[model samples]
Target: MPLPNTSIAHALDLADARHWTRQPPKRPATRLRHLLRQTTPSALALRLFAYPHTLTRWAEGDLDGLTPAQATLIEREIYRTWQPEVRRRAHQQILDHGGCVTAQLHARFAYTTRSGEFHDPRLLNVIEDLPALHARHLFDARHRDAADDELRRILADGIGEAYFFCALPPDQQQAALTISDLHLIHFHY
Candidate 1:
């Protein structure tokens, strides 16, 4: 497939990541404690655009019954829920491990359905929706396969709005509109 349209993507090379570190976490437990700790929010949010989260994984799987609009919302919730994870790992990599990763994929999508008008992929977490999602997830899961499909689609097709917000970088690094012939939208990793 075509490389993910560059708009929703962010690239942090070893060089770019080098300056973003702190001392590596001494224990995995402590590492887990650092997420959403304020210092790491903005940076991690930026990094999220590139790292492949649950939503990305879904796109890569069978999307026979999914849609971009559904993908869009599911992506948002999944994206929001991942904040803590993203922060902690960022610490491990940049802070603890010298930011040794070869790169980060934030939310770069590689494929998407060519159908719907783009959905807004920007995260509007309301900051307190984590618990709400957790509560609803069980209920949603009972309805369909996509039950767990996306927080963004039931919920991330449930994600993009690129104006997927993530798919469209402010830099215009590349254009965001990568209309495709497929149904499920997949981001670059």
Candidate 2:
């Protein structure tokens, strides 16, 4: 299928190349036992994208420390397990939405909550609620005063007005939009 997004495609490619040349440990049975003892399916699934090599080590029963190449291979194997049509449709949806934050959040929620079921109606309900959930998350992250009536009034009034940010009182503006140092650096660029 065509690449979903340039960055994801590049990362996948790099992972594949790294996995191809990895060597197994000499004592395979012992390594496998060690890995299996430590692994749980849920943990494996969650780490599949970010730490593919760790999963590969468990799968291969490899006691040797993970190498960069092994991680790449693990990523390719994870990708191989995905249903091609589902992945293609998901990619298209992200692309269609211009890869906005909301689109990415939806994709993440879908991936993290996936079970053996396909297109479960309950899943759609969760997706429909994600925007409000995300907005609340942002609010919670920015301000510690979620329970304050004054804060609620400020948000209710400010959000509906033009120049919403500018309309906020100085203290309310700081409370509502105070992103962390990490985000400041990210947004700066």
Candidate 3:
């Protein structure tokens, strides 16, 4: 029995995705930040296919004067030590009652884990979000950092995910398969 004529490493790198990510065109900007408030997360993911810069302000968490919708989108998209909604409610309660929920975040991540079974689909919160978390724990922070570096590359500009998925090691790619529900990874190959 012979394997098929395709490479698992070459599986999902769609051409447009590759082009958009690897060589983002230099384009003049005008009111691009406004685009975020008007776009849904899913639509924004596809829009990154042609215009990755349109997401800059939102991705950078520069929502200073942006509308509530834009800020909410950022809150929903990024992981902090805790969910912003829960934090906000706790803060509000403290303003009124002078006491609030407490938390200590030595680290926060965008991780997922699963059962030992190869086909498991449940996402277990563990460790990830390299840049945001400084690769704290659950990452080979020492040396020969192959897996962590690979994950960082996939998350580099946000647009590289689909194009980079197949390039991950088998176990990592398998883990990614369960994360499409979060819209962070997709199997377009």
RMSD of each: 18.3, 17.2, 18.5
List lDDT for all candidates, in order. 0.32, 0.33, 0.32
Candidate closest to the true structure, highest TM-score:
1
- What lDDT tens digits, residue by residue, belong to model 2 across residues 125-160? 111112333333323432341332333233223222
TM-score of each: 0.21, 0.20, 0.17
Where does model 2 exceed 4 Å of error? 1-8, 11-60, 76-81, 92-189
Instruction: Give the Cα RMSD of candidate 1.
Output: 18.3
TM-score (C-alpha) between model 1 and the true structure: 0.21
Q: Pick the winner on lDDT between candidates 1 and 2.
A: 2
Best-performing candidate as measured by lDDT: 2
Error in Å for residue 14 of model 1: 17
Question: What overall lDDT, based on C-alpha atoms, would model 2 receive against the true structure?
Answer: 0.33
| Per-residue accuracy of model 1 over 127-186 as CA lDDT, tens digit each | 111222322332243223232234233222222331234545456433333322222222
